[model samples]
Target: MTTEPTAADAVGPEQEAVETALVETVVASFDHCPDPRLKEIMVSLTRHLHAFIRNVRLTEQEWAAGIDFLTEAGHITDDVRQEFILLSDTLGASMQTVNVNNVAYADATEATVFGPFFVEDSPRVELGGDVSFGAPGEPCWVEGQVTDTAGKPLAGARIEVWEADEDGLYDVQRDAGRRAARGHLFSDENGEYRFWGLTPTPYPIPDDGPVGKMLAAVGRSPLRTSHLHFMVSHPGARTLVTHIFPEGDPIMWKDSVFGVKESLIKRFEHQPAGTPTPDGRQLKTAWRRVRFDIVLAPAGA
Candidate 1:
């Protein structure tokens, strides 16, 4: 059949040329940016973004929907909630950024997403003090040591820890002016630190927002594995933000944020009721315990 080509069929090469030119034009627009780093970022972003659009053959309707999604995400964000971070975490962008910035050094602990839940000015607890702050969950004894990559103990390291309660909610998610299941403490002279925390339980990342809707549309689960959060920092060392997942957690392989690493998994040993705690705090209910020895890479490593 000899039929004349339609306008759409004839637009291939010319359309691609126009798109490439637009990408270059947008990229060049950042050349005058005073900040060298900002210029590099903008130029690269323009190229990748334009390539994504072209590769997907994105439709106007799809583009509009994406804008609407981001708008909702922004509209719902507040001091306690960060929809944009959730979007990034779910898309694995946050983890990739962490990987790039936290290059592996000699035995330095692997880094993971700095989840949006971390808050500043968390109450300070002494070594061996309770960080649970009366949050609801089985008692957990978390003990660890902070050391340099060379195995030298690093005393006076500030260790910040936080976790959700049994009901899968952080203190920030509750009524305003509430705090629980989070605190900061310093390592002792021996570089040893210990505190009471809730037994980490698997929970869905806040799934009631736009990010949740997107996950549902894609048939993805929003559940994070059982884990405890820690941020450790010391002089002349790279600050470490990571989570320790319990060994044998069924969902460990499917963490929604893709934060799991084999080295970060530790066994959560069970203690029978009436078992003497490390600090001799008598707890009538059975509790769990875990130890995490942290190694920090030197700054600029």
Candidate 2:
């Protein structure tokens, strides 16, 4: 005994009731979805979206423009960059996502958003090697240890590191002949890793695109808080993605990336010794030093 479709369903009336029905249809679709994580995300997203539509009384014209803007954002992606990540960074979504997952930072390196610029297989260098590649900036010696919560040296941990140049740009963003300011290093038996590079400098986010326009509309600067990037991982340990924001950086307290945590902010010590290079050339009038430790969670926990 099948019943006929009602007039409300057949007419597909373009009214508020129709909008409500559309929203209900979307909500009903989630009930049949299987993946717990995906279901959670989609359900929450749909709820918030419906609320936004109701609250703002969003019009078809506005939504069409929003879709077009997103399509344009997609057109901006390339091998070395991602516009959507730029959108997330500009909107503070990246930081929010990281913060939700990293509830505690006790003796642990704070996880930060891995921006689209991170390129793997960065030149592998030895301890005390300089990846600065002659860029102009304050010389810095970064020394750090990778360990477990129990303080055991994380032997053979792969330390993936990258940083922008003195002028605030990554190698992927420029055409430097040499591998500019990026490398990978393995921690030693003592769970120690060291590298020589310029101290991090504050720089702007990609603001020339729609993401940048959005930030400008919101009266925000696109600058990232000054910091260095690290991806430290070991066997049977959690891989850590984090930043070492410079102490006393104006933006340190308000990192645009939301990568800042009390433990990850490191002080740069000014060395008056003016250490000489291997060839005896005076490195700089004032060199900086930073020491920090990273702790990882047990694997598969």
Q: What is the TM-score of each candidate against the true structure?
A: 0.95, 0.86
Best by TM-score: 1
Q: What local lDDT does model 1 show for residue 214?
A: 98
User: How big is the positional error of residue 242 in model 2, measured in Å on the Cα after superposition?
Assistant: 0.2
Per-structure clash totals for the candidates: 0, 1
Write model 1 residue lDDT over 43-97, tens digit each, in one string: 8888888777776677899999999999999999999999999999999999999
| RMSD (Å) per prediction | 4.0, 7.2
- CA lDDT of each prediction against the hidden true structure: 0.92, 0.78
Alpha-carbon deviation at 227 in model 2, angstroms: 0.4
